[model samples]
Target: MELDRSGRVLAALSVAPALAMAGWLMAGLPLLLLGRFAPLPMLLLGVPAAALLCWAGTRQAGKVVEATVWQVAGVVAVAAASAVFNGVMHSEQLIVRRDPATYAQYAAWIAGHGGLPISVQPEAFGGADPWLLFEGVGFYGVDGGVAPQFMPGAPMMFALGHWLGVPFAVPAVLGGLAVLTVAGVVARLAGARWAVLAALTFAVSMPILYTSRTTFSEIPSLILLFGGLALAHDALGRPGWGRGLLAGLVFGLAVLVRVDGLRDVLPVLAFAGLLIAMRRSSRSTGSARPYGALGLPLAAGLVAGAGLGMLAAYLLARPYLSYLSSSVRPLLFICGGVLLLTLAGTAAAPMLSRIRLPRWAPAVGAGLVVLLMAALYVRPWLQTVTRDPVTPEDRRTFAMIESIQRANGMPADGRLLYFENSLHWVIWYVGLPVVVLATIAAAVLVRRLLRDGTPFDWLLPLAVIGWTTVTTLLRPEITPDHPWAARRLVPIVIPGLILLAAYALSRLRTRRWWVTAAAVLVVLVPPAVTSIGTAFTPVERGEAAAVEAMCAELPPDASVLVVERVTGDRFTQLVRGMCDRPAAEVKRAGAETAPEAEVRRLIERVRAAGRVPVVLAAAPGQVAPYGPATHVIALVTRQDERSLVDAPNGTWGLGIDVWMAVAR
Candidate 1:
């Protein structure tokens, strides 16, 4: 089991692809910003940049023994298999109701046009009728443009799939990339041997699988975060400016994928500052060991990455940014305060280092960690977190909760967020054995750090993972559902806990096969089986074909006016983007109803604009009155079910019908 310098270099090669994947994602930002997202140009710049990043991340990796040939190959095989399986079974979430479709459509427009502010094409719709709304769910209608929700980072990566003519393949690759990065971190932090165990445990979990099979931002964010972790671990040892710069860039670029990434990397910001502070302290002052020379570049890269993300948000996706202003404002404030505190800590480093700690402090801290977990479990009995349905979104959330409650036969309380059961959600996904092992590892690691901070590599990662995990467990902010709510845990908690849990298992000095097998079975079985119902069952099949057929029916220059509720909710963007037509959904005359007067007036306007007007509906009867009804889309698929009170067991039936009439 002994390793040499060659082992260290081999470990670097093992993780190099993971870092390159992350770098490629980051590299797309410039192309997207410049509105020149051509494949040739993107690959030309991205390939070499990715290669450079791999070199930077791995150059100093030779300082640590983190992986072996067998271990690396084993982890890679599992990761490759995950990517292929996920690709084969990937969901065709082309219609907009949730995030996946939003991302699909977003990436679609970007790939097709290589620009932002998706044109509303008001000229075809007779100059923006008051009776029409250009936006669909997750797509916002700005002054004269359509904007996609969420950060552009994941979509930027997904755009490659469209450029390559295999859109789902991007998610599959990212899913696999996520696995490799997880293995890399486990290899570096715990030991080289435990990497595959951690990878297997993580790859089979429902959250990882679920996010990977669809276009969720979580997978890309997870990859970037963990890829950065792999780089940062190596940099912490050799303290090269390039290594720290790349690590911090990817870490901060995660914010480009998800806004909450800012919150997640707060510890990184703090750790960078701490490193600078310790670097200034002298041996005469009995200061802790300096972290060589990593802090400044790491801090600079983080700031630069964050600045780029915010700039992209401001320039390209303004409507989405405006909508998230309330949440974004507070996060910005918190970051500012943390930066100020870091500066203060640096100034006071010498004074801070002279302080001493009690030997029993580690034991006390460990006991407190256990106490916190126990308290979270006991919290439901004492507290019920609820908010009044005051805002429009709050009311919608309340209604969704009530419907889910009724479906599950639980008491209907629209106000409940179910934040109290957060830890239980973790159990439902990763199992009790993992939770036990992770808790033990975290507590023991904390104890070791306090007693003697010799396990120096664990410093920044533990700070980052532990902080995000605990904060999220305390207030998940997402709706309480099996996989939907589990998005909060996907990026960090699931993988972080599994890695630590594996590290804990590696500590067991047992030679017995039965003992090892029992441990593996206990830690791995529950999570792998938890998602049994849906892992093999693909959702939203044949949806892309249905959409294509629907799009093909409409002429390239047709102006679509959707008059039905379901049709508008589902096909607004599909018509606008895929059909390459100007599409608008009439504003509701009543509860999810289109006003006949407005619909007819819009039809006249479309005619006046010298374009074929198409009236779209979910039924033959709804569109037949305009002209002769043409059946465009008939889709029958399954969708993931929502649950708040109890865990979701399976999916529900989904049916989509679109009918259109071309008015001459």
Candidate 2:
């Protein structure tokens, strides 16, 4: 029984995710155990683990599971192409965004210092002060010490690259892995050809490209999420304790990366439970008892595996949980509730199997459940928008939209309208036609899954695509930037939609190869061209250059005060991360005094520490009191107002004046 092309592709696809997941998990263990995550250790442990998993999968796969050389080559080719494309588009310099800069610094510290710093005091001006808070660096000042606000998953990966002396290695590698995982899953569910197409579509997406270049959480999160889904699919097909446990572990690790992943993977738990419940339904009475014996261990393995995964995530992320105060309770409830439901469902599977219903009954129930969930998720956003005086965050976003509209010679009154149309921002990158088609394809897939009791391999993809699409469209709370806000959709929704579209195309009954090829090109070329164009477009370098100049003019041991009236604390982190300066921010808080008094106080404090004091201000008035006594080291003047759509909290290309107070 030599495997056909499709069988071979499916087999390879199943094995790939488990191998990747095992590799990442094995690689990360040392970080947990030794408090340092390095590439050499990761590869040393991970490669062997992956190879062993591959060997095990192959041995158990029997004669019907053999990927051809061409099939393997094709997957690798797509992954390599994705890696190259993302590497080329990688940011030449870090942008004004706080998160990416912070994550980079976190990685740098881990790479250089071997663990999370006891205090980011080294990066603080005049050393660590119990009372002083570091506003922009994204570190939590708690109990007289500072800790990184983000989870360690992304930083752990970045530490590997830093170890290798490659700045962009983490994103490049993870981005390629994400593409490969999507392709592999698509191959397993749809076919080998669609897998290739899905990988290409994801590689060319503008949002994907933009994210791949930066140190964002989405890429790493996607790697875990997709990898988990692939493994879970394999487990569903194989129905073994080992496979189930591995899937659970991968899913759990995803939560460690992004807490929100707990929401993304709920369906997997339900799917696993369903599999357990139905395992004995198809067996004969003679074999029913034997099958029932097998089902208990399978169910227990899955539950135990997932429980362990969640427990590991909680232990790893306990420190960062403080920063996510609002989310802690809900996340705990969701995890707890899902585990309980899985146990209950597994326990009651025999009873559930005895109950029969109309074919449409399950579909109807699922639809109602999805609607209720969507409504629950969207309620807060709806309430927010309906408020009389818009929230401060929304107000700022609206103002930015109005400014962009005014610049483009469009009506500035469409701020609310823009917010409403934020859901359609996907159209801006992939085109309206593709979005519409994908929506239709999504609908078709959902209908098929509900109507036909498809296997887990088929059901999981549709569930992911459908769930992410609905959630993204209903709750696009991010600022309505053309391609950037669309980033919220990139990790799952966009790629999922692309796969759905590819699957839809594959279903077409056309036998002509050219016809299929042309259809795929037509669907993908527009976005690819748009993404390529954006990739080549130079990043705004003026702001970065001005920062560099400021760093150069100031003394090596300068304690800089960023006095930002509009862009508060944004440049503080950038300066600290990029220029290796100990920086702080002076905002509307603190004592109200004359600018001269404030400048004198700041200068005296720095002078007491034997470091020079510098002020970087967004407005001239903020620095006016310093007078001619202060040297104007670097000034950046922009003709237009900086649009805050992409980075709502930060200002990019904004006019800035840098001043250095003359040392006494």
- Tens digits of lDDT, candidate 2, 471-503: 666656565555556567776777776766776
Worst 10 residues of 2 by lDDT: 638-647
Model 1 Cα shift for residue 306 (angstroms): 1.5
lDDT of 2 at 47: 65
The number of the candidate with the highest TM-score is 1
Using lDDT as the measure, which candidate wins? Answer: 1
TM-score of 2: 0.79
Steric clashes per prediction: 0, 0
How does candidate 1 score on lDDT? 0.82
Candidate 2 off by > 4 Å = 1-75, 93-95, 122-132, 280-336, 359-423, 431-452, 529-533, 538-556, 565-568, 575-581, 587-594, 610-662
TM-score of 1: 0.96
